[model samples]
Target: MIDLHAHSTRSDGRLTPGALVARAAEAGVTTFALTDHDTIDGLDEARTAANTHDITFIDGVEVSVTWQRRTLHVVGLAFDRGNAALTEGLATLQQVRRDRAKRIAAKIEKLGVADAWSRAQALAAAGQITRPHFARLLIEDGVCRNNNQAFKKHLRPGRDAHVTVEWASLDDAVAWIQGAGGIAVLAHPFGYGFSAAWRRRALAAFAQAGGDALEICTGTTDRQQEITAARDAAQHGLAGSAGSDFHAPEQFWLGLGRLRALPGGLPAVWHDPRFPGADAAN
Candidate 1:
């Protein structure tokens, strides 16, 4: 099976890129993508390992975009890895992410979470120190009971330490992916808590923005949610995509390629003209 959405230590994941690829191979994943958050440093190592393992490695990265005042994640698959525009855009994003991380650290410091910022950064080992890394540190240091507690009490948006800044628009994000010779797929549509009407509107907007596919199956979304997403994709004429969104072994529910099957009646978004195999759709 193909698991297109994954993470490694290049961003927030626990495993190194090579180890992540090796684990996916052991999990029976034949086609995989290391779509780490806001970074492609893991891709080179993952690609090398995929070659050794005889697996197909689809070039990917998850780009964050702002739409309608909310943060949305868009996954780019099979992009030209060396495209200058895409690389420049991601470099800018990395800087923005670092600035935001520092702000979060300062906010937590004011909240009397002593040394949490420094400790978290040290734990991150010079990689991107995400809110999750902070949350885990808080949990380990007895500041919070667990990762969820850390976020719920101190780190969620509009709370004390949340500081994710809007860096790119949805249109520009999709355009970058397409311009880099990739297919842009909306990641985990329901994560934003959009109403039915809002979802329809967003899908229309995304399609117009050059998005090629919508993730119909991902992580542990239920069958009903899958059907809902599949129907929405069909109505909007989006392609179908699936992935595990896997991060670590502790997240056993998020096994490689673990996803509900797409409802059979829908026209796959991968069949859209933007995909390489679009002609086979007919």
Candidate 2:
């Protein structure tokens, strides 16, 4: 099985790159992508572990993009990590993330969370600082019962700790991915919380910007949703991609390589020339 989206300690994920790859290998994933949020720092370690386990590793990154004033993720797969355009773009995003983290910490501190910034930094452990780290710290301090509660009470949009930062534009993100010899896939469209018309407009904008695929299955058991995504992909002349979007081991519903297969007659993202057996029919 192939999993085109995942994370590690390079971002907010719980596992180190090596451990994440090991888990993917153990889960019978023949091909895996380490699409860490806004950073490719974990790719080297993941590649080494995948090599050791005889798994095909795809170089990838999940870029945060601002589309129609909303935050969305665009996954770039099979990219040249050394490409200057992609590297520079990611550096810019990382700086924005750092600033956003500081703002979030400040806002949460005003709400009576002592040493919030320090706690989040400590939790991150030299990895990228993310909202999840803050959420985890809140949970540990008994401010919230779990990650979901933490987000609901503080981190989600319009909440106290929600710091809005402008991310790269969709066109720029897609261009950076394409410039780096990668195909851009709109990650988990259904997760965007947009109306059907807005979703269509977003997809059209993405396709116009040179995006190559849409995620048809993202570890959800909803067969109807999966089929609808596939139909949308076909309608837009885009290939279909699947991923678990796995972050932590406790998220059993999103286990690696265990996602439902893409619907019949949909073009698989792996059919791209960068992957082996690309010539084979999907």
Candidate 3:
């Protein structure tokens, strides 16, 4: 199966790019995409690993975007990994993330957690510092039971430690991905929890802004929900895709390379015109 969505340690995922590729091969994935959060830094390692393992790999990135005041994650697949414009945009995002992480660390310190920044820095170890790194450190220090607890108690939206980040606009994000010769996909539509009207508006805006597909089935979403999302994509004349969104080995519920088939009657996003001959390439 083609698992078109995933992450690596270049973002909040537990594994490195090469490690993730090896794991996917072991898990029986014939094709995969390394859609790491907001960056393509992991692509080189993943590509090399895929070459070694003979797994068909797609260059991908999950860009964090803002639309109507909500965070929208758009996954760009089959991109030109060496595109200069895309790399420049990602560099800006990485800087924004660094700033947000620093603020989170500062807030945690005021809550009597000294050395939080140092702790996160150490844990990140030259990797991109993120809220998950802080969460992991919190778990290690017995401050929180797990990453979920840390997010719930300190890092989630509207909490003291929650910092509002300015993500790229949907149009700009889609343009960047398209410029990189990628198919832009709407990642996990249900995760936003939007109203029906809001969802319609979002989908219309995405199509207008040049999005290619919607991830109908992803980890944590049920079959019914997946069907509904698939229908939504079809109604919007978009293509459908699926993935496990795997992050760690222990997340059995989200096994590596496991994916539900896209709903029937929907054309594959690989054939969509929003992408530069993604269908032809595949």
Candidate 4:
């Protein structure tokens, strides 16, 4: 199977890079991409593990972008991970993430949580700090019953701790991915909760901004949505991509290599010349 999006401990994922890749190989994933969020630090280790396991590894990163006032993710696959421009841009984004985490901690502290920043940092353990770390801390501190409760009470948008920060624009994100010899794919279009008309508009803008593909099948098993996404991508002259968006092993439905195949007759992102032989399964 071909799975184009996943994460490791380099970001918010539970598994380490090597472990994630090893699991993918064991699960029969022939082509795998470790598209960790806002960072490529795990790619080198993941590539090494993939080599050992005889699996094809693609250098990938999931860049967060702000479009029409909503945060969206763009997955860049087969990129030059060491390209100077891409690295510089990602550095800027990492700084933004750090600053946002601090702001969120301060906001939640005002709501009676003490030393949230330090606690969350401790939980991160040298990895990049993310909202999930804070949520875990909240659950540990008895502030919330679970991760979902933490988000509903403090971290979700418009909540007390939600701090809005401008991320890279869609055009700039697509440019960086293209500049680094990668294809920019709209990651999990259905996850955005946009209305049907709004979804079309966003897809149009993404295509105009040089996005090359749409995620026709993500972690979800909603066949109707997958078909609709594939049809829309084809209508917009964009290629189709699929991923499990796997993060933790507990999310059984989204286990590595478990995604349904992309709808028949849709052009595949892996079919590009840059990824020769990757489309063999398709």
Candidate 5:
């Protein structure tokens, strides 16, 4: 099976890159991509592990994007990790994330977590303080029960710990991925909870901005979400991609390579030879 999206300790995930690849290999994932959030630091380790397991590793990143003031993710696959454009672009976004994380820490401080940033940093392997780190801190401090509750009660918009950071634009994100010889895919097209009309407009804008595909089958998607994303991909002339969005073993529903296949009549992302492991995937 082919899973075009997942994460590791290089980002918010629980496993190391090697462990991630080992697990994917065990799960029969022939084509795997470690699309960590705004970073490619784990690619070397992941690639080495994939080589050992005979699994094809695709250089990937889930780029954070702000479209019309709403945060969304764009998955870049089969990219050159050394390309200056993509490297520098992701670095810029990394700083943006750090700043937002600090702001979140400041907000959480008011809720009596004085060392919020420090605590969150301790949990992050690379010092990349993500919202999940904060969520973990909240859980440890008895602020929330779980990841979902942490986001809903503390971190999401209108919450006390919420902090909004303006991420890269759609055009720039797509350009960075393409410039690095990668395919830019809209990640989880329906997960943002936008209205149907809004999703249509956003999908059109993504296509116009040169996005190459959309995830028609994501880890968290239901039948309605999959069907809608597939229709959106077709209407915009984009390819269909499947991603588990796997972060950790605890998130069982998003186990490595656990995503459903694309619905009938949709063109898969690996249909293009440029996609990593397309030969084996097809």
Candidate 6:
């Protein structure tokens, strides 16, 4: 199986990097990428574990991008993790995420929650603090039942705990990925709740800004959406990529490489020989 997007405790995920790779291997994921949110701290560990488990490990990261004042994710695949430009770009995002987490915790505190920031810190440990950590806090407080409910009730935009933070522009993010010798893919377009026309505009802009691919098969996308995404990506001259976007085992809607085949007749982002095991994955 080919799974180009996944997370680890290096970001908001539940498992550690090594454990994440082991889990994916158990799930029959042959080609995998550790696309941790805004950080590559887990890549080295995940790569080591992938080697041990005889899995194809792709160096990847999920960048947070603000396009038209809305936060979206861009997946950087087969990148040079040591590339200075990519590392520096991700560093800035790391700080932005930390600040956002603190702001969210402050808001939660204002709602009479005690020691919100410290408790969130304890939950995160050395990992990057994210909204999921906050969601766990909400779950613990009995404010919500799960991550989805936490978002719907309080953490999502237009909610009490939501604090908007400026993220990297789409152009800057795509540039950084390209600089790292990576392909930039728009991740899970349908997950953003954009109408068809709006999605087209976003795909057009992404392709115009040098994005190379868009995810067609993903945990959040259905069969019809996959077909539409493939058609849209072809129209925009972008390739089709697929991934599970797996974060945690408890996430009911996500799994390791559980996506269907990429829509036929579309270019694949990993067709290039530079990405190891590309032939086998196809």
In model 2, what is the error at residue 59, expressed in angstroms? 0.5
Which structure is stronger by lDDT: 3 or 4? Answer: 4
Residue 270, candidate 5: how far off, in angstroms?
0.8
Q: What's the CA error at residue 2 for candidate 1, in Å?
A: 1.0
Instruction: Give one digit per residue, the lDDT tens place, for model 3 in 26-72.
Output: 99887788988888888889999999998878888899997887899
Q: Give model 5's TM-score versus the native structure.
A: 0.96
TM match of model 6 to true structure: 0.96
Model 1 weakest lDDT span, ten residues long:
273-282
Put down candidate 6 lDDT per residue, 189-276, tens digits, no spaces.
9988888788888888899898999999998788998998899988988888998888888877778988899888997887855566
Please provide, for model 2 over 71-141, each residue's C-alpha lDDT reduced to its tens digit, 9 standing for 90 to 100: 88999999899999999999999999999999999987877778988888888886899999988778877
Off by over 4 Å in 3: 271-282
Q: Give the Å shift of residue 213 in candidate 4.
A: 0.4
Q: lDDT of model 5 at residue 12?
A: 86
Q: What is the lDDT of every predicted structure here?
A: 0.82, 0.90, 0.83, 0.89, 0.88, 0.89
lDDT of prediction 1: 0.82
Instruction: List the lowest-lDDT window of 10 residues for candidate 2.
Output: 273-282
- When 1 and 4 are scored with TM-score, the better candidate is 4
Give the better candidate number (4 or 5) by lDDT.
4
Assess every candidate by TM-score. 0.92, 0.97, 0.93, 0.96, 0.96, 0.96
- Pitting candidate 2 against candidate 5, the one with the higher TM-score is 2
Model 5 bad stretches (over 4 Å) = none
Q: Pick the candidate with the highest lDDT.
A: 2
Models, CA RMSD each: 2.5, 1.4, 2.1, 1.3, 1.3, 1.2
All candidates in order of lDDT, best leading: 2, 4, 6, 5, 3, 1
RMSD after Cα superposition, model 6: 1.2
Clashing pairs in 4: none
Q: What residue pairs clash in candidate 2, if any at all?
A: none
